[model samples]
Target: MPKKTDRHRPEPTSHTEPDLAKAKAVSIACGRRRFLIGLGALASAPLWPALRSAEAKAPAAAHWPGYADAMVIDALGGPGEYAAEPYAALSDKALADVRASGLSAVNVTVSGVGSYAKNPDETIRNIAYWNAQIAAHPDRLMLVRTAEQLALAKASGRLGLIYGFQDATPIGEDLDQVERFDQFGVRVFQLTYNRRNLVGDGCLEPGNAGLSRFGYALVEKLNEQRLLIDLAHGGERTTREAIARSNGPVAISHTGCAALAALPRNKTDTELRELAAKGGVAGIYLMPFLRIKGQPTADDLIAHIEHAINVCGEDHVGIGSDGTLSPIDFNDEFRRKHAADVADRRARGISAPGEEPDVYTFLPDLNSADRLDTLAGLLARRGHSDARIAKILGGNFARLFATAWSPA
Candidate 1:
């Protein structure tokens, strides 16, 4: 339903160069450091009894799931082009790191902004690549489009691989493409990115017009197919309209609450409440700008989650760290790249209304993918119940998956 455009698509297999040695080495070093830090902390603390009691009462599995993180990105290698790294290339070593992180699943984005396939064949290729990855790593990873698949993968002691699209551009203006992708196990589809498309206005757009007719139709088609609609980068009005139009539950797959930080990209309390009322989930993102600007500590992230829980209740909230796979110094390089892209589009008259010149300037303290466990610990310290912690960590997304996935 959303209109499509010709953005530069990243080449398949561009980013998949294998780095098993590097990944494994990093994993080992990090583990050692964590062990030392834990020992030091235990030894230094005079109030050992209180700390021990808290540790004993803390939920062992609440912070990190048994499996590796269910979501992954390529930027971890370094921010060049996403396609420069294929997921398959690192399946073995990546799974090792993921397993070490105590995560059980990962949602992988096959097609993203500027990397759409023109025809069905290319689409099939994308899907096939992911399918092959699942097949190759059956011992460590399993393809999962539904909650049942996730459970099966967990039971089998493997990480679940979920296919997702970062933008709807890959569908290329054809509603039928949605069906094709649905068949390919794409359980999630974002409505828009940073710019306006045929579907609806993006969050960066100044003149937010809500959902267009095509967007509404797309929502209907997605609902009929039981595909989860994600409104992460959509405008405020667009988000509300999509929520109102969707027949089934929708999701803000990875975002934060505006009330906590007032960033344009974050959702408002009212919108979050509406989403929860519809049995939808609002995944709280852990990006820096989404929290308090310069000094966004883990507490800031937890506060946003808390605020969202207060607004939408626990079952409707989850975590979606929009972290890139790379470990760039949380500084100007990343911000400059994002700003240039948005600026170029605007200069070409393809920009949204509220688009900022320096869109990525606000960098958070916890900038890397590995900080997720620390975030979970902060949440526990903030008094999150074990059940609620599980929901926020990944259970909410699991429920959404169950609601959206359709088996063949």
Candidate 2:
């Protein structure tokens, strides 16, 4: 775990501190300085003040609406199904889990996983598939195109699904599709997955080429449409530049602190600070990237969250659990499927730097419909103020939604 940084003038994590991480980020930024345009706002801006008044840390609150009314927004997630069948209609337990999860909205993958820059037909197919799913289970789920619908779904007890993609491949050369996809109910987009594409290099790419002209153009168009941009799975330079150049608040939808555990998929203090200063949010994911050894635990998750809050402030931090709300069975059949998926990613040269054969993709103890409840309880026990917990859970993201989906 990382040693807590002083509230003011925070530094990148030790693994990627001034000696290494900062040097790497600086080197990439300098290498691509000529291409880094439209970043005058970030360069001219000063640090933002703390969002709320309170001690650096506060005691737990027994009150504050508990988990039921927390507006628990999952920044990134998957179809919350744990059954053996794939894409079967939601089981009784599945629906119960989602209904019980109390999630206001979850950014679900409508683009499917992996890079699709070469062919966007698959992306279109994905949108069609998800449309069918929504149509099939109108009672259990609903499409969330705007922020208002997110609130409505929560109030109605249906799992609100915010269509999103893990890669920019879906956009391809058709920049006009940004609004087209938004009209199709897609609201979140990422520049890259785990490899270079028309948009940019992913976190795994050795060259760290950052965003390209097409990537810049795509981002600008997305801003016009007011879509929420995400920088997860992007290279350091890509993440930093995207956050700096984006005209509106973006999200590092799912990542851990590189300082806590040195991994290319994790982020540095510079990226986190810049995103927060601009009123953006960063989500600490649940995966092997959070620590150097053993399976990821609740403590590791908390450490990353606290470190993010410390660097980015309370208002600019939130949860983006990169897994499904349901627990993964690691049963024999699923293990085979998991191995095939990892091998496929590695074969395609898009596997992230931190992935390994024996590692699990999610935290076991915190893997449940009550995951948010368990996490909120843990934060409460850690002395996080109720207001801070509320923001981290969903309030902050709700505000971001309203901003990005403005004029809706």
Number of the predicted model whose lDDT against the real structure is largest: 2
For all predicted structures, in order, the TM-scores are: 0.70, 0.82
User: What's the TM for model 2?
Assistant: 0.82
Off by over 4 Å in 1: 1-88, 91-93, 114-126, 324-370, 406-408
- lDDT of the candidates, in the order given: 0.60, 0.73
lDDT of 1 by residue, 123-149 (tens): 567778767766766676677777777
Error of 1 at 384 (Å): 1.3
The digit string of per-residue lDDT tens for model 2 on 117-216 reads 4446777777787788778888878999887898898888888889898887777678987877888888999878878888988888889999999988
Provide the clashing-pair count of each candidate structure.
32, 1
Q: Pick the candidate with the highest TM-score.
A: 2
> Candidate 1 local accuracy as lDDT?
0.60
